[model samples]
Target: MKTKFLLDPNITFLNHGSFGAVPREVFAVYQQWQRTLENQPVRLLGRKLPSELRAVKSALGSVLNANPENLLLISNVTFGLNLAARSLNLQSGDEILTTTHEYGACLNTLKYLAHKSGARLVQQPVSMPLKSPEDVIEEIWSGVSPKTRLLFLSHITSPTASRFPVAQLCRRANRAGILSIIDGAHAPGQLEIDLAEINADIYMGNCHKWMLSPRGAGFLYAGSAVQAILEPLVVSWGWNVDTPATPEMGLLENLQWTGTYDPSAFLSIPAAIDFQRKHNWINVHMSAQETLSRFLHRFSESFNIPIAYTPEADPYIQMAVLLLPPIKDPEKFQNQLWCKYAIEIPCIEWQEHQFLRVSYQVYNTEADLDRLFSAIEDLMPSFLTTSSHTKSGSL
Candidate 1:
């Protein structure tokens, strides 16, 4: 299974949560699409691209339990999120409610929108050691008011690595007439996503991250009611004033055709989906979970840092966030891990506590976790004791 990925065997790549490792088979398919596009650019882009994109969307929609008509393949989650954010016709005194644990890029998008619109950006602080899904919903909902026009949240948070209860929040927002936008960048492959069941007004996911697609693969899913509000971020072939709209050229036409660009990543989505299916990703996920649980247990005992969630109410599926002792410099420690040990992982300082967000893909094994544990054990003293020792000397 490890041979399937292109990641270097010498480096213990634990940061799958950051930017996913593409399977070699999937990368081959991605390259094939690129070559096919380059062979006859006009024929591929002008003639066959639309139909090919529809097929890709159909395959992706099948995995998400969403309608292809409601989906548009964007460059990435940030691009999709920007489309959703800029589409909202915000006004003064309105608010966009979100959690404090959102991905920084998406949060920045929301902040800019909020600032431009004179809408307040409320960061509802949901404390650590999360209790339950109901509790999460309640805490977020508490920030809502009559002026709350939109609810934005991550399906699986980037920094915290906690799975948010988006379905319940979406349902509540619907009832309250507040539009819901979910950044499901980490959800598509990490969890079973049924968009129909989730029923978010505007949902965007990154196929490149968890779904094992090539980079630049992601999409935005808008419900029928919200589609009218959305205009393409880049207006090119999608919205031509000269050409009249046809029945077939409906929502997809409006959002899909954003000028000529490399559609290889978009076209490779089906191949990636097929790859995951053929490999029986459910079992892979389970094995990863077991490994993560074991690693978390040992890491907690080793560092005296607690795990954020419990089994009965676990938010994460294949990822877990390890609460670390207050390191004087988290960025330095993270860099040292990469530079010294060739251990790639994300360490963040969120809400005054440091956390290591570990992602377990099929390629990772217990031995990988063992190596990480050993490295941390050996380096903890240096990271904690030498706060001002700027030199990258041996511990």
Candidate 2:
């Protein structure tokens, strides 16, 4: 099938785990919303915007299995995490436990919060060559203590692309009386997400990443119990203390409308959902996952790379990270792949070994994987022989 959204045909785009490419149809809908807003800015923003956003949230909620009241549309997962971080009631000696394999931006957010609240951010280490979901949950929970107040985790990690057993961990957190915050940035489109089933106290996901919406589209799902505890990062008209607003009003006023900004991205959520349905995304995802597994198996064997996780244990979608040989200059080697071969994939340095993460979408094919394989085959020998060659080619 031909790709309907992405126009970048020249480059072998395997970086859907990063900022996702939007589908043309959904993007058209986004633009239409933008134009409508521009045509009647006053009516759109002041009168129709709230109702429009509520409908969008309802549509998204039905798919996510979330309460429409609890979910607020945000720009990105980072923004949602930032709101949570700022709202957390951390104190000295309170520990925020997390895995070592989290996204760097989320890690930084946790660090900033820790510094501000005098709370310790404890990073639990999970060794590679993951066997099962239970093993992951065990390794992560072993780090939690009586002082652990919060459990932060990624549903699907950015660097490693391994799917964590967040649902089970969230249950463990509940028993321990620790708050759970899950970064589900890559999980929404890649997996069948039932937020109620997962039951994290706070969960955030990006529609922009894998959901194929426009940039500046994401959601924060806070459980009804924890809604009152969260303070909005931006204090707008929503924080009117004199008005004695309802709980719903508090959420809309404080979090939903965060000053003046384009709501086109949020308004386009239904279109993104509809696009997936029209394309039969479930079948597409399963097919893509199988293709990715085969490619990973072949690529890893050819390059003498190690597999980070077993296929059966963490097979949620089309993202996988292969462990490569330890490179002296990973940054340089990463750049060489892009500069020489027009390959777009993430090369990460994690715990000494370098990792090459390949994210497959509907647009990717075996031909794309072949180009990446060819590029690696050509570059690996040169990188091992001459270190300086890499530096010269890299940006």
Candidate 3:
């Protein structure tokens, strides 16, 4: 039996990693929230918003194992990271150490901060053909030094789709007195997240990606110790000369409601959580993982490509990146996949190698993989071949 969602069935949607597709039931609840707000905007935003927000935050906190006080809803991981990067106090000669496998936007965000703070942004090169997660930890940690003030890394890498050993890295950073900021854009619903156990200074995740929430739903978690250092991206009415009775309450008042935007997306988080729980999200995840592993085995064997990360190192989530032959232009190849084949996988160029990333969700099935497989098979001989056959040089 196949699952139903708001996605169009006509297209083979293999790009759930980019922007997740929300289920119809969950979206219906989201729309209902929107309708409720539209009915009486003044009442929803003024009279009842605070209580509603507290309820949503409490539910999200239960799932993340975080204090509702320390958590603040943001538009996305980018928004949260931007706030953290801007709020931190970095001195000149300080080094911001990170891996080269991080998402491009996040790298840019760090670069922007480094440039402003007069600190050097050092990217530690992590070679592929990785044996284990320990290799990743060692490679990334080797760059840390007395000059290193902060360590920023992705829980699951973007381009390579390899899951880094964030917990181990966080422990090492803590021991060395370095602040850790983790970009968990793909982690929340994809994996079991225990914020207390991981214990990073700041962690940001996207609900839209794996949590199957509405777009622009994300949260930033600040450890109690570091909460004082975090400044809202947009300074609004929340900033005050005197501290409020509750720091968490102050954070919600100041940071959560930034200049009157729609809170429906944020309100729908509980519904997304309930939808997944009622449907047994773990079973859905395991089923997707099994199918993805099978498809990956077949696809890699057919194309003579090796798996970039091991199952033990990076277990199957909603997404995985397969290393492919280096292409001259990865963006062009991605465009071809979309325009010619209607296949929506992401082709990323990382470490001079090309990667074809596929994302599987509850709405995806074996037939979807079969379609992608058939498309790649058709493209391999004529388009992906080494020799140029056409004048346009697409093949």
Candidate 4:
């Protein structure tokens, strides 16, 4: 599986939750689309691009269990969320409620929108040793008020790598008449996504992360009810409500043609999906989960570091956040791990605690976890002992 990917073989990569590695075959398809567009730019852009986007949408919709007409292909999750944030009609004194576990970019987008609209952006706090879905629901729902016009949350958190119960949360918001906008950036490939079942008002995901598509591939999905409120982030030919050039152009078409850029990554999404399907991704996912669980147990026992969550209760399928012994400088520890050992992984600082997030993909193996363990074991003593003054001086 590792051999099929374009990732550098020399480096141990445990950060698939970040920018994903593209398979060789998928990259070939992506490049071929680019070449085809280059060969006949006018025809492809003018005659074929619309149909191509529609086909891609249908393919994605089938997998996502969403309506093709309601989906818009965007560059990444942040881009999609930006479109959503701008489209939302937030007003003075309204609150857009979210949790602290959200991705920073999305959080900033919300903050910017809140500032622009005079709406308050509230960050609901969630604690570690995370409890059940019901508990999380109650804690998060406590933040919701009559002023909460929007509910934004991550399906799988980036900082702590905890999977929130978005479906239940969405239901709560829907009952309260609050619009639900879920950031599923890490969920498309990491978990089973049946948007039909989840029923959020608006949802967005990144295909470039766990989905294994080329970079800059993501989609924004809006429910039929919310279509009218969606305004285009960039005004273009497809949508000019004042002029009304083509009244037929709906939300999907209006947002799809947001100027000319490389749509090759978007086109190759089906190839990435097909690659996962052919390989029996569920088994691969289970294998990786089991491997991760084993590694977490051993690492926890070896270092006497407490595990954040029980294995049975943890919802982080392939990615687990391992709490580390208190380190003086997390940034230095992360840099040293990558620079000294070529072990590429996420060392996160959340809630004033240090954690190492390990991501397991189809391309990863038990050997990769062993390498990480060995590297950290060798570096932990020095990392803990190194004086903050020394680190500050070096910096």
Q: TM-score for each prediction?
A: 0.95, 0.95, 0.94, 0.95
Alpha carbon lDDT of each predicted model: 0.87, 0.85, 0.83, 0.87
Model 1 Cα RMSD, Å?
Answer: 3.9
**Lowest-sum lDDT 10-residue window in model 3:** 386-395
User: Number of clashes in every candidate structure?
Assistant: 0, 1, 0, 0
Judge candidate 4 against the unseen true structure and give its global Cα lDDT, from 0 to 1: 0.87
Alpha-carbon runs more than 4 Å astray in model 4: 243-248, 385-395
Question: In model 3, which regions exceed 4 Å deviation?
Answer: 1-3, 242-249, 385-395
Worst 10 residues of 4 by lDDT: 386-395
What overall lDDT, based on C-alpha atoms, would model 1 receive against the true structure? Answer: 0.87
Candidate 2 vs candidate 3, lDDT winner: 2
If both were scored by lDDT, which would come out higher, candidate 2 or candidate 4?
A: 4
Once fitted onto the true fold, the runs of candidate 1 whose alpha carbons sit more than 4 angstroms away are: 241-248, 385-395
TM-score: model 2 vs. ground truth: 0.95
The TM-score that candidate 3 achieves is 0.94
lDDT of candidate 3? 0.83
Per-residue lDDT of candidate 3, residues 1-395 (tens digit): 23558776677888989988888877998999999999999999989998898898899999999988878888899999999989989988999999888899999999999999999999998877554778878899899988999999999778877677788899899999999999999998988899998999999999998899999899999887788787778876677668643563655446776788888889999988998888898988788877878887887687766676666575457788766654466787778778887778898777656778889888888888898888767765544545222311111
